[model samples]
Every structure is written in structure tokens, then in C-alpha cells.
Target chain A: MSALGHFLETAGIATAGISLVRENTELMRPPRALWVPFELGRPFGAPHAPAFQMRVLLSALALLDRTDGPVILEDFPDDAPESDSTASLVCPVNFPKPPNPDESDLLRAVLAETASLAPWHALFMETHGRSIATVSGLDIDAAARYAAAFLEPRSNPEPPEGRDQASTLRFAIEDLRNWRLEAITAQPGPKPSSKTLADWFWGETATGALALALHPVLLESTSPRLRQVGKGQLVPRAQQHRLG
Target chain B: MVRLSDMTADDAAHLLSKNCPSFPGEPFVAGPPLKERRVAIVTTAGLHRTTDTVFDLTDIGYRVIPGNVQAADLAMSHASVNFDRSGFQDDVNVVFPIDRLREMKAAGEIGAMADFHYSVMGAGWEPHEIEPTALEMAALLHQDNVDAALLVPV
Candidate 1:
């Protein structure tokens, strides 16, 4: 999703991802927002294979300039991505899948926690440790279950005991190039009127494998809000290229 | 021949942009041109009807249009979807053409048909997830090797 913003940034298309599941929908920083709170299964991937998961990831980047309005993408099959292999089981680490916690209880926990964000966030934090941020409704437990089912079973490679180190933490904070990002500010430009905003064109300028570089900008020049966007809303278009 | 007015809000589109990079993406790929060639359509507008069993309300987005319908009839009937200030298509299939693609085939614009059209009402938040579906579909299309593909927005 960050990649989409990058491309859009270059394209002068003011693009935003539905990222404020928790705080701001800004996918990360600078030219962000448009955030929607959902699990990876529904938002971007099925589960198991990293390859398929990434395909949908890149596809989202592709939408940077495809539509004028907010774009909601589906990653599941008929309903949601089936990571049942993971979601349905407790843990694949042990020989036989461990008896899972009750789904009814789980469902209840989910419903009861609807208004509360603490437990869910706590759970994710416990399992994954921590990250810059996490989306709402991402139920890591659900992800755990899905992971168990979706990913091919890998024998436990841990040496039984895991060690914690400051180096790891320092590396994560200081050097994770992918995770480290900057918030791109919108350049001042003409703002379009409501009527004009209604006529904006959406398209993609990003391409290639992982596509971390694509970012979509809202073009206000052709619309009514061109003035506001120019002052704020509109993102400049990227370099022109021959569209055959 | 598709007038903007002809389409109901779901039929007409205000603007269109290519998802693939312009410079890198050649008009005609080495194999068959994605145009005038048999193609498959996919949608992230998250479409599935009650009858179809692919629908998921929790999946997010509008479900007015069937996301996975073959793209044959709709292309001709509704050239564009109703325009909104910030949305692609209101009724649905905002990004995939499971319908119009089929119509083109009937009209002889395309030569063959893909076995299955893909649909996902994916609220784009992550990038890794979309990769597999694309690979799966791309591989499917490659195996089928149609002249070209027509990917319309839901």
C-alpha cells in the first residue's frame, strides 16, 4: 500500500489508502489515510503461500490511479481468503493439531470486544511483540488460525528457547528499510470545486514485481476542486508517458 | 456508442486510468494483444450475490453488482457507470469486467473465453495478499493464452 502512495506521489496523483483503522488511515505517512480496518485475509491475501498474498498486495498498488473514488479490494475466494488451514487449527507446531479454543467463545469474545480495542491489540502485541502500528479488527488470533491452515507445515526450527536482544530491536527500529517510511506532505496547488472534484480521473502509474514505488495522487487540475487540491487536496500528476 | 447518460448510476464511469505502468507496459505484449484478445476479468469491488455464495458483507464495499459475472452483456448495455466525486462505480464491479468481456466475445471482438472469472471485494490495505490472486489468474490466462485481456473496474 505504501508503494502505491510512492507512485502516486511521483505521478502527482494525490492518493490515500484507507489506513486509519486505529488512528489515521494514512497507509503509513505522507499521502496516507484511506484506511480500512480488516485482516490480511480479507484486505490483501488468502493465507498460506506468501506468493499469492503478495499478488494482491501489488494489485492494490495498481489501483492508485484506476478509479476516481475510494477503492475497496477483495482478497478472499467466494467469501474471504481461506486461511482455514491456519484459522481452523490451534497450532501446527506440535505433531497433532492441538485442540483449539472454542469458536463459540471466540465469536463471543469478538462480539463483546466490538467496542473495546485493548484486548485485540493486546493479543496481537503479545504474539507479534510490536510494530510501528497495527490495524483494527486484525484479530491476530484469527491470523494465527489461518496461518496454521494456509501455510505449508514447516517443522519447528526454533532451538526450543528463543532469545531476546537489543540488537534485534535496534535493527528493527533503525534499519528496516521497508518499514521505515516518511510522511509525504501534499504540495499546495489549486483546489477544485465540488462539481470538479466529481470529475476527477483515477489511474495507476506503478508497475513491476513488488511495486513498492507506486503512489496515486488526486488530479484536481481537470476538476472543480482543483483549487482546494492545489492548496491541499489535489496531487500533481506524474511525468507523462505514452499510453499505448 | 455508449453514451454516459445511457448507463444507470452503475453503468457509466467518470474517468478511466491504466493500472499497469504506462512506460513499462507496452501496448501489445509479446503474445497476444490484451485488446481484441480473449480475456478474463477480476474485481476488487468485493462482489458476490446471495445466490452465488461468493458474497461476504464483512468483506466490505458495495455489492450492488455481481463481481464475477462474465463480461459480455454489460459492456454493450452499460458503457459507463454513474460518476461520484470519489468512487469508481456505485452499483458495483467498479474494477473488473466479468460481464462486458463476455459481450465482446459475443460480438467477435474477442476469440476465446477464460474458464473462470475472478472477483474479490478487497478493501486495499495490504499488498502481499493481492499477489497470489494475480499470479493465479495470470497463470490461468497464460495457460489459456488468449489474444488479450480486458480488465474493467468494478
Candidate 2:
């Protein structure tokens, strides 16, 4: 981010940016930056927080007026509002655990899970008027089937036209994960922290199990793209501990 | 919450070890006071309209987001999955902040919003590799008569 700032400022356009990683910003030394103390994905503090988001935005933009130096990096004074971590989100669906779960079993479990969560996901769309599940260009059912096809040892599913198999798999998985998260959050309850939601998805859900099962299959595949996805993209770095 | 000390050693090291290009000169062009500058958002959140193309692993190109984009129309295809996305799922303002910028314009905090904003995937390439794309975006901003760009990262 700071690097883009340097390039823009060098090109004669004034730039002010939010610095999520102060260390990185210090190295690049952008013309103007506000080092925020929030999490990685949220540079503006928190969701649905207009006033706080404004304060952060104004602080960053305010630096454009300062003529003090070529580089200015300041920190936001406060932390984001802490999420309700103590709140336990109960899964509305009761997925039956399959004994000696094989590829077919895992696929069936995932399909069942998605079918159960469909209504909740629909409710989420109705209330929120949007979803992050549109990346794959496949609806939930097709995404489930596309992702589940990877479970086969020798059969590689044909990706959507003009799309590579590896990327399609990644998008399908992301769609599934986002769809499930949206469904879970749509239930009537306190909003869970990202940590809580992650734990539930990775540690408890059938979709999580399917992803974990795909890791080795992808890593051992002949395709380098799939191997790359398996190495760092399929499972987040923070969730790698769940791998057996 | 995202302090390096709180993260796994490998994750923290990877971020810190990323190569950041250093330029010889520090160019700081002074813009008008807050209320007189035409502001635009330049984000590295891999955002684009839902109907647009998804970002590829090696894509360094950017997508143009109009000033009047709707929340439902936006989708993220950033290659990295390490960051939190639930915040964005709940509210686009968390990552995009277009709504807040609109409010600032309405309140005269800034002169006006640019007719177009920009978004690019922040991962899959070195920091220095963003120069060409940045230059192109800067030209677009200049054409739009934007004086200040609020660079947002996710």
C-alpha cells in the first residue's frame, strides 16, 4: 500500500494512506500515512461503525494538509471496538458425522450441510442485499458439486469455460465458505468475532473437513497451480494447525 | 489486534520480510485544504463489480470502480486468504469506505468525490511491481481532476 503511495506521489499526485503494518510503512516511507491499530482486513476499524470509520478516514486525509516533511506516519489513538467473543453461536443444522468418512461420504455431508443452510443463506441475502459468494459464478449447489469433485483421486472436474481448474477450485471453495459463513451469521444471535466464526468453520463444519481432505490431494497433484493453492491459498496460515 | 507479536512467527516474518522499494527522492506535493480537494479512493482490496473479472494469482492490473457503485455489486477476489473478510461481508464500508467518503463530500469535508475510484489485488507480486499500475491509476485520477487520493489497504 505504502509502495503505491510512493509511486503515486512520485508521479506528482498527492497521496495519503492507511498503514496496517507500521513496520512495512516505515521501510517504504510513503509521503503520508496513518498507521492503524486495527486488524488486517479492516483498515477502517470496524464494520457498521460510521463515526469510528470517519475518524480514521479524516485522520489519514488530514495528513495531506501537513507540510512538515516528505514522510509522515502517525498512529490512530484508539483500538477498534472489541467483538463479543464470549457469545457462542449455535449451529442451526445438526450434521450427522459419517463413520469412516471417505470421499463420497464427505461429499454427501457437504451437500447435506449446504442444503440445510440454503434457507439461512437466502435470508442473509434478503436482509443484507448482498453476498460475497458471487466470485465463482456458480450458485451454491454447483459450487458444492464442483468443489466436491476434487475429492476423486483420478477424475479432475472440468472448470467453467475459460477458467483454469485450480483457480476454479479455489473460487468454488471460497464461495462455499462465504456462503456458509453468511448462513451462520444470518441466524438470530449476537455477531461473532472473526476468530469465533473461523474456529467454527475450520474446527466443526463439514465444509471445513472437505477442505482439509483436499489439502493432501492438491499438494500431491501434478499441476503446479493446484500445488501453489494447496501450499498457501487453500488453508489460511492461521488455520494450518488444524491439518492432521 | 493484528500486532506482529500476536501472530504466528512464520506469518509475522513473511509480512516483515516483504521487499519494499525505496525511491531516492521523497516527493510530497501539497494539495488544497481538506474542504477544497477532490478526493478519490484507491484501494488494494481486490474489489470489482460482481460482473467483472476475478483477479488472477499474478494479476497486477486494477479494476475501475465508479463513484456510485452499490454494495451488492462489489466482490473481492484477492488471492490471499490470510486476512479477515467477515467485516467486509457484513459491511462494504469497512474495506471500501465509499459511503463515508460520500458523506464527507455531502458535509463539505472534501470538495467532491471523483467520478471513479480504483481497486487492485494487493498480493501475488512484489511491492515495487505496482509502479506501472500506480502510474496508470494516477493518470486516470489526474484526468478526473482529483487532487488527493486516499489509499486504502485491506
Candidate 3:
């Protein structure tokens, strides 16, 4: 409903999202999260352009003002071409702090696994990354700090048989942004390789993007509260031959 | 579902009617469907085979063109993926391991072969256009009463 934002705001949905976005002031004036991207039919944005999309977003948020907005959708650029605001990243930017001894040891074990891998193993890993992206306000350090404060260990308790050094290095550096990095950083450890460090960093960006993109699909498959979409969710119907 | 490797198109039609979800009003009938199996796979992300043309699944997201996803395309978007992810620098989209599908079919994970594999142009903020296109093929699979479909998403 155009009333969805009003409903969420007057109710308490905005309060819930406050923690996730860390913009409490915005929460007090809850806006509806548009289900789609781009400028037209839905509140979500278009292909790559970030600023225009965010403006559309902030405008959507402004609609929450029961007293101020009669024409809640005042700024959506109906005329803007359907443009993708962001490009694919060359590498995941934004580095986090380093590792602790146990984490370092864990990194060592993962590297040991990668060191033993066969040349052909690249086949599985090449195609097996996630499709999510992240778009919250939290900086990489805040995200990392949040991670270290509350973390648990899982996966590859020991390296798999025949893992390669670099591959294992990737395994170690993977998702440090989601772990207790400050604690890890505080603890003493050997220097992680430049290669391992980079993998850890890029892996975060890749992982975040994947998380962003596949949200609907994975949620469709798994979430208990089903995500609802209108015909508004229809993807851009262009069939231009994709560039080869 | 007919398990036979080879059957007339009519039998294929009969089987699909019995198995797949029937559309409104139309009797669920089976048999030869689609122009040909001509099936392609699109991953959850944009992964490509190294030997073929490449598509990136990272920040830009996944995309599958009509032909192979080349390494050069993926490399343009993600040099790190090319240098580290691809078993070979030249081949792209190998990460999804369509080669494994080829192997699986050869080793008999199932019968027949996937004629094509696909990737998304980018990640989740945007959605995919393949669903409608798939129904065109799904109708055929439904008609033929195809045994099962295994879609691997990256």
C-alpha cells in the first residue's frame, strides 16, 4: 500500500531496521523499503546508478512524514534512463584488521589444505561463490568490530585432503569481516601473506555482493516469512542480445 | 516419468501430461515439447567455464549470453577471479563447473546433455529475466514428463 510506509512507521517496523542500518534518526521517521530497484514502477532502484537510486530511496523515506508529504513520491526520476549505477568491482575494496593466534592457526591450517590441492580443483571453486551484495551504512571497520564482538567458529576444522596453498590461503582469509577481528588482531600471530590478506578482503566484497543479489532467491527458498512482490517486481523486460 | 533414453515425441508428450503441473483448463498432456531440448543452465551467480567465453558473478553480477562465457569478459570485471579462481586464466565461467555437468552426464548422473549454460549479469539488487523464457522450455519438459531437473546455482 502507499500506506505501507505509514503503516510501518506508525507501527514499529522502522524501529526494527534501526539496528541494521544504524541510523536511529531515520528510524524515527520510518520509510517503506521499496521491493524493487530502479526509478519507475517500484521503490527499489535501477541497474547501476547508486546516487539516483539512493535519492529515490531517501524520497521514499521522506514519505513517512504523515504531516509533510501529500505527494510522497516527489523526487523519483521518472525520466532517468534505466541505468545501472554501480559497476562490477575490480576487487573487493575496504580492508579489515588482521588475525589472532587461534585464527592465525586456523588460517595456517586452511592454507595447509590449499597447498595440497590439485590444479583441477579450480573447477569447483571457480563457479561456487555466492550472489549477495551489501548496501548498509556500516563501514568495513564497524562491521568487523561488530563481527568480533559476537562470533563463533565453523567449517574446515581441518583442511581437506589435497588442498593447495593459495586456495587454502583463500579459505583462511575468507569472511574475516564477519568474524571477531579485533580480538584476532589483538592476539599475537605471524604475518598473514599478502596473497592471503587480499583474498580475505576481496572475498568479503564478493560475498557481500552475492548476499545482496541472491536475497530474494534464497529468501524464496528458505525464509519463513515469505517476501511478497507485486507485478511491480517484474524485471526490466529488455531482450537486447547480451554482449558476448 | 519415462526413463527411456530414446522415445518417440508422442510418448514424451504423454509422460509430461502425467507428471508436470497442468495449466488452467488445458488437459495436462505430454509428448515432444520445445523445438529441441536445447536447454541451458543459468547459475545463481555469474560463473563461467575457463575454456568458454567468460561472465563475472561478482559485483557486476551474473549474465549468460547466447554462447560461451569467455574468460576475457570475466577478467575485465574481476582480475582476481581470473588469476585465482579460474583453473586456467584464459577460460571464464569454469567456476560453475559446467565441465562437471559434462562429466556427470558422461559418468551417468543422468541421460542426455545440457546444450548451454547461463549466468546472471550481476547480483541480487536486480532480478533475472530468465523465468519467462524458462516456462517456454518448462512447458516442454512438463509435456514430455521429464524425470527431474537439477539446477545448480552459484
Candidate 4:
């Protein structure tokens, strides 16, 4: 959005932005930015909180009055809604882990957990009138297999049609991540905090292990930007493996 | 409470290691005071009218959101778990705030509102993919005579 905001300014449209990831907004440095401390996807503040939302919008637009500097990142002076529910987030799904597992064992564990959550995932979709499979237009099982296939040492399969090798791989990674989260969200009672889901994916699941394993395949691609993006932009550093 | 300073040292260090764009150009000034300026909104929230084609998750392009649309008339296609859309699910004002913009217009907080707003799926891993689309959206907003814009990122 910072890039878009910059372009909008160049076109004589004064612009101000509300940011979710402060580091990202700082890097791009839009003309005027309001760094909200809210979670991603809820930039205006709490759901259904009109006064707060209006305040956020007004605060961001206030930046338009700045006449001097190239950029300003003002903090939206409000505490983020307390996420007390996140204190002890536990994903409900569990697949037995094998001791001292290899890549294939980890892959199997990931797929098994996905399959185990299929029924609950379907129920979650039913309530929302949507499914991740419907959104991506790929069967969940096929998507899992597609991602897992890349983890094998000698697979080197063709990329999905219309996408280059790196993009296809990237999409696969995201697809699996979303699926895992969907399953976790489907469990009855309070959903895990977004941070917990992220931690579990990177710290507790084989999915993260697979992503780390696939880092080399992504870097070995012909596109240097793809390498930089996959290693530098796409995956978090904790989930990224060092390249020689 | 979730300040950037609250980020773990490792996560912060890793994030700071990535390249970020720096601008040397002067900031654009509102041609007139905000009360006399025309304003609009642009979001990276993948928001669109319910009747429009939903955004492809990886799409770098944009969708047009009519300014006076209803909250029930909007839908978001972003699939990240990082955000809780319960608020947006109930009232889009929590994310897009077209209604609030309209209210602000009525209250003279801003002079006028554009007839259309803009939305793009902002989840793309590659930032370069969005440049052309952003430029195109900028041209359209310029043509619309938008004097200032409020950008919301989700």
C-alpha cells in the first residue's frame, strides 16, 4: 500500500495509510502512515466499533496536512484491544509424532493432520458458506500432495499451469498454511490467537519443516527476485534456513 | 500494546534485515484544507462488492468499490488468519469505513466524497507485482479528481 500511496501522491492525490505490519510500512515509507497496533485484517480497530474506526480514518487522513517531509509514520495513539484469548492458545488437532523422524515422516504427519481435520474443516466451511478448496479451486488432498511432493529429494515436478516454478511453490506453501489454520479454527470453543496459529505452524508443525526444506528449491530457481522474495520476503526468518 | 517494540528480538532483527524503500521526494500537500477537499478511500483488504468477481488470493490487481455501498454489499477475499474479520463480517466500517466517510462528509469533516473507492488483494509475496496495478489505480483516482485519499491496509 505504501507503493500505491506514493503513486497516488504523484498523481496529485494526497494520501494517508493505516498499517498492520509496522516494519513493512516503514520499509516502503508511504507519504503519510498511521501505524495501528491492531492485528492484521482489522486495521480500523475492533469489529463494529464505529467511533474507533472513524477516529482511525481521521487520524490517517490528518497526515495529508503535512507540508514538509517526504514521509511521516505516526503511531495511532490507542492500545490494541486486549487479546486475552491468546494467552494459552492450543490447536485442537493432533497427529502422533514419530521419534527422530526424517523428511518423509514429517510430511506424512502433516498430511495426516490435514486429513484428520477434514470433517471439522468442512463444518467450518458450511457455517461460513465457503471453503478453502472452493477459494483455491484445488482439492485439499491434491494441494497437500502437491506441496509434499516438492519436499522429496528427487521430485523436480512441473509447476502448476500458468505459474512459474517459484510462484507455484509459493502458492502451495500458502495453500497448506491456510488449510492448517482453517482446521485449527474449526475446533469448537475459542479459536487460537492469530499469533499462536503462526507459532504452531512455524514451531510445532511439519508444514514449517517442509517450508524450511523447500527453501533451497526456491532459491535454485532462475529468477533472482523469486529467490530474494522467497527467502527474504515470503517466509519469516525463524522458518527460513540459511543458504550457503 | 502490540507495539513494534514488542516484537521479539529475532523477529525484529530478521525483519530489519530485509530491504525497504526510502523516499527523498517531498510530501504531497492537500491543495486545500481538508474541510474543503474531496476525499476517497483505498484498501489492501481484498474488499469488493458482493456482485463483483472475488479477488484471486494472489492477484496483484484491484477492484472498484462504489462509495455509497452498504456494508452487507461488501465481501473480503483475503484468507490470512492474522486478522479477525468478525468486525468486518458484521460491519465493513471496521476496515473500509465508507459509511463513516459519508458521515464525515455530512458533518463537514471533509468537503466531498468520491463516487468510487478502491480495493486490492494485498497479500502478494512479491511487492513489484503490484506496481503497475497501483499506477493504474492512481490514474483512475486522478481522473476522478480525488483530492486526497485514506489508505487502509489489512
In terms of DockQ, the best-performing candidate is 2
Cα shift from native, residue A110, model 2 (Å): 1.1
Residue pairs clashing, model 2: none
Per-residue lDDT of candidate 2, residues A1-244 (tens digit): 8888888888778999999988888888888899988888999989999999999999999998899978888999999977777767766556565644577888888888888888998899999999998898788778878887887878789988888889888988899899989999998878888889888888788888888888988999899999998998899888999887
- lDDT per residue for candidate 3 within B59-116, as digits (tens), equals 3333343334433333222212211221212222223333333443554433444444
Docking level for model 3? incorrect
Worst 10 residues of 3 chain A by lDDT: A15-24
For model 1, the docking class works out as incorrect
- True-structure RMSD for candidate 2: 1.3
How would you encode candidate 4's per-residue C-alpha lDDT over A1-244 as one tens digit per residue? 7777877777677888887778777778787888988765578776446788788888887777777667889988896555335545344446454544455776777777677777877776666544333233345656556666765666665665654554455556666766666666666665445566667776666666666656666677566745754564446643443322
What shift in Å separates residue B132 of candidate 3 from its native position after superposition?
Answer: 3.6
- List chain A TM-scores, every candidate, in order: 0.23, 0.96, 0.23, 0.72
lDDT by residue for model 3 (A21-126), tens: 1121122232322222121111222222344434433343233332332221232334323322231222212323233323333333333322322122333234
Model 4 agreement with the true structure over B49-95: per-residue lDDT tens digits: 76676565477778898876866567666634334444454346778
TM-score order, best first, reads 2, 4, 1, 3
Better of 2 and 4 by lDDT: 2
* Candidate number that wins on lDDT, 1 or 4: 4
lDDT for each residue of candidate 1 in B1-154, tens digit (9 for 90 to 100): 1122433332222112112221211111223322334444444443333233222222322223332453221211110112121111111222333333454456564555666554454432343334444445445445654333333222
Please provide, for model 1 over A27-129, each residue's C-alpha lDDT reduced to its tens digit, 9 standing for 90 to 100: 2232323232232112322222334433433333333334333333322222223321221111101121113423343333323322233343345335434
Return whichever of 1 and 2 wins on DockQ: 2
